[model samples]
Target: MFWALFLLPAWAVAGSACLRLCLAAVRAAATAPEAAGDDRALTLYEAAFLSGGPRRVADLTLVSMARQRRLLLAHTGWATVVDPRGRDEMERSVIGAIGPGGQSRIAPVRAAAAGTEAVRGLADRLVGAGLAVQDGAGSIAAGVRRVRLAALAVCALAALALALPVPSDLPDRLVALWFALPLALTLGSLLIARMEVHPYSRWASPAGQRLLTALTRRPGAPADDPAQLTAVALLGVHAVGEPDLRAAFAHRERYLEEPAAPGH
Candidate 1:
């Protein structure tokens, strides 16, 4: 009982510190300009080539026309059955722009009953890219934790050694090994995690490389891009009562340029 009481405050303090660290990391990541840059690059890439800018408008018009003709049916009221022929036309256009890689070559467009997969795929790519800086920040937090854990382990071993009247050679060796091995691994992991790979980093044309990455990650419809795009669209539609695609695209660009709030 006495030992449990003595340990309670330590546990509380550690937990509090962990919470504080997590919150601080997220806040720092969210406000960072680099994180926002990822979003801008993705939006521009998609607008120029993939699903959003002109093609989506054209497709929507086609879909609307089809719906009016009753040649199409609504799956649930939220979606209408899109013509496979229209999909083929779009695929040809995409192939002309990017090349013959099927859905694998297209960065955002994915197969779905209605084009929901394609839209969602575009959104996911944007969100994932935006998260690069955040991931880096979290990695930094993790590195710090690793260091702290190593320190704590060392301290604990020392305390254990001291508490034992018969200080065996085995205990000292075990403590040394624990400190040495984990310290090396932690440093390596931290270095790799901290490597700065900007989310905004794009190709010369920007579309091809991004698409390739998307394809490599997902070989199926409903790729990450659409998911991300949907999120942004939903936010715009719900929060501001306007599906301001241009504004949504610009939001990321402006955020990226907004000088990372002094220190972070």
Candidate 2:
């Protein structure tokens, strides 16, 4: 009984979080509008921004620079500039982020590029064009995070309920019922969220996703071009059929394990 008393607050908090997430999911779905005709023809960078947010744009820019031979990304995660000139604002921003040395760690370059006017411009353009869901995207992401936390809280509550002693007056079944309520609520909320949010990508709304799908289906598409390569980075390797370009976009981790000595 004392354990149940201790778990009551957790149960309440989890239940509330679950309810809020469900409401948020429903509201996002209900308020989302259909895309306009012109909005369907999204540029590679624009699609990247819509599908993966500002970070995707930065990734595309880096990949584009590498493809153009203006930058080199070593497996060690260092980025070096081959050409100091930047033809466009996005390219210029990336080169500028590398600083006067013309070389820096990829992670810091990404961080700096993420704050550039070019990235901000891309986001603003997407939102203004109605291809991105503005405040709703952040809200949905937050709600999903809360739902995940609620799942953890439910597990904690269950463990607490089981570990604590029960009163003589209360049956084991009653104790189980109490714990089951919050668990069910949490699970149900997750289910609703999955169904409602599954159609939309991380940043792109349903309409943008639909357009992305159509654009990726065309045959004999060129993946070597900077624009096409940018699309490949956004849509992932599956969308790029060319082996060479696919290899170019293949992500390498920053750290690598050194080989052991021959004697060892």
Which candidate should be chosen as best, given TM-score against the real structure? Answer: 2
Candidate with top lDDT is 2
Local accuracy by lDDT, each model:
0.35, 0.67
Deviation in angstroms for 110 in model 1? 12
Please state the error at residue 200 of candidate 2 in Å: 5.2
- Models 1 onward score TM values of 0.24, 0.77
Cα error of candidate 1 at position 225, Å: 16
- lDDT string, candidate 1, 1-264, tens digits: 222332344344444444544454444445434434423333323432232333442233323333334222122111122323343343333323322322111112222212444434444554445432223234334435644664465445445544556634455556445444434544444344346322222111123234435533544333434323332221221222223323332232123232322121
List runs of model 1 lying over 4 Å from the truth: 2-80, 85-264
In model 1, the Cα lDDT at residue 92 comes to 33
lDDT of 2 by residue, 1-264 (tens): 565674587678777787666665564455345533333566777767776777677777887777677888764456789999998888899899999988776666777887899988877776665556565445566677787787787778777666666653567677667777777777887777787676535565555666676666756444445345745545643465545444434533342433332111
